[model samples]
Target chain A: MKIKLSELFFVCVKIGALLLGGGYVIVPLLVSEFSEKRAWLSREEIIDFYAMGQCIPGIIAPNTIMLAGYKLRGKTGAFCALLGLTLAPFVAILLIASFVSLLLKSVVVNDIFWGVNVAVIILIILTVKEVWSVSIIDKLTMLFFLTAFFMCIFGISPAIIILLAVLLGTLRAKFLKGEAK
Target chain B: MTFLLLCFEFAKIGLFSFGGGYATLPFLYHMSEVYGWFSSNELSQMLAVSSITPGPVGLNVATFAGFKTAGILGSFCATMSIMLPSFFFVLLVSKMLKKFKDSPVLNSIMYTLRPVCAAMLAAVAFRLFLESVVKFNNFSDFVFNNVDFKAFLLFVILLIFSLKIKKDPLIYLAFGAIAGILLHFGHLFA
Candidate 1:
């Protein structure tokens, strides 16, 4: 299970550079690279990493890669993965910022951006459907989805909602599932 | 001092912004009001560019905002600091994850978290859709104004195609850009 830092870095760098949309889309891309192609991790492990990404505080994409890299080769692997992921966007945006003032104008650029935005939104919605079918299993999970949805819409912070879910989940495990020690 | 301040502020954002990239929008909006680093309009433009760009939306905006406030160094600091928290956090949590792998409490937490995550994803997707596709100032405006029919139609077409074909997303993205230019040119003639 010893992974070369160079390989980890390059794989993540490629993913960071080419993958568009947002964090949710990163999961499928990672699965294809690590699980299907490399056999680095199983598909279920990637899904677990996706879940762990959600539970954590910061951005999902970086966190997921960190876990993947760490699982592969400990601390160095994690740093390599993180560096690979951030390096592309940092350089890309910095380059773009130089001419952003000009780019913001030109109705042509705006039109292209508007079209790309629509496409990215569609990509996100497709991810939503894919995640939803797997995540929502029964009445209780449905209730969790509804509660989270309303709480998000009502301007509640996501941290608070996630915290509340953890508390409720722990309680359920303790009393209802009867697995508490 | 400015570099440190930028790092601190972005670190705070990275620590707090949950759900995903779009969740950071509210905090960025607040920064515009208070910090004067970037305007709301510029933030929207950054968002658009970020969406089209190859990385996470939040990180891209942080870089743009930092570059706007100071320069290239500022962009580096802001991006690094924003991601710093997650870097340390994953290290810590993943270390502990092994010991707690079989704990029922952890299992239940994840079970419940899946649905919550689903809801958060759906909410952000819907919000982005409304912002991009649906245009109306108010309820009355909705009644009086026409929806962006072309964008809506394109969305439906792409959605169906993606679901059926299951191909790479870049194809749809390129198609969208082409369609956009054609539609814009078509409008010019009319």
Candidate 2:
């Protein structure tokens, strides 16, 4: 059966709208969405999409959506998925604006947000752990995590840290003796 | 001039931020600190708002930051800037997927990005932690009372549970929320 572009569009939007914990959550969801639910793609294909998604730039989920779109329908599919995924949060945020006053101002609610903020903290740290397992390895890479941790916690400039990491990472990649087989 | 500059700035994030959207946090943190387009507290609030909402945290953040910077137009410029790169880059990659599918050059570039990504994420988490835990306002309270043992104790308890729990972040968030509610309303808790 030929897939309608609209169905593909909503798939991306639905995934973006209800999903939690951000990009990492998208990883497994992509596997299930394309491989299991939609049956439009295979598991290996989704992984390939993820690899490509991570390799390029921007954000991962949109990239993944683009990849999934391509898998489902080709160029038009890719852009449509991108548009759908991108628009979801943009529209959601816009709607959220009307509630911003009450959400931020209420005393009882402020108490909830205060608690929620710490939970956000833990959630972020969990995200860090999830990404760490995938990206960081070796002593040098580990050092980068430590350095960045100290600089940020101490209120050092993040641009400085990013530039330093880029420089150091480039040098390490260039100068290191061994090649991965 | 302003619209183009804002696009260029966020576009840099699109092009460079490795690991993911959170990786853009450091660059953004610096933007807030150095440029004063947005304040540190505002950025923290943006981050919290982004996390609770659905979709990519990074994109949500860029939209919030942009909106704050240049109003609706800024929001448009910033969001589009970060987005365009990935759209084009992925398109380009998809075209050449077969040619570079197994290339070592790609692997090396990705490897080099690992630490930078870590640093970016660490920057984001650390800033959030400081904003939540560190109190710059109550400086005198430190010397005179040392009464923040309550906050300290909560942190320790939360930290332990966070580490021990299986995959639930909501548990900690709920824990923090309950504690906050109790502190404010419950007389016996304090």
Highest DockQ scorer: 1
Q: What residue runs in model 2 are displaced by over 4 Å at the alpha carbon?
A: A134-136, A146-181, B98-101, B136-154, B168-184, B187-190
Q: What are the per-residue Cα lDDT tens digits for candidate 2 across A1-181?
A: 9899998888788877765656667767777776799788888888888878887777888888897787677788898888777777887766664476667786666666666667666666666777788667888667767776777766676555555655765565566535432
Best by TM-score: 2
Task: Categorize the docking of model 2.
Answer: medium
Question: What are the per-residue Cα lDDT tens digits for candidate 2 across B19-42?
Answer: 666777877877776678888777
Please give the distance, in angstroms, between residue A132's alpha carbon in candidate 1 and its true position after superposition: 1.2
Judged by DockQ cut-offs, is candidate 1 incorrect, acceptable, medium or high?
medium
Q: Kindly report the TM-score of the first chain in candidate 1.
A: 0.72
DockQ of each: 0.53, 0.52
**Candidate 1 lDDT, B1-190, residue by residue in tens:** 8888889888887876665676566567667767788876577678778777888887888888999988998998888888888888888888898655677777787788767866766666665566567864346557424667788998998888887887665676788888889888987999
Query: Model 2, DockQ value?
Result: 0.52
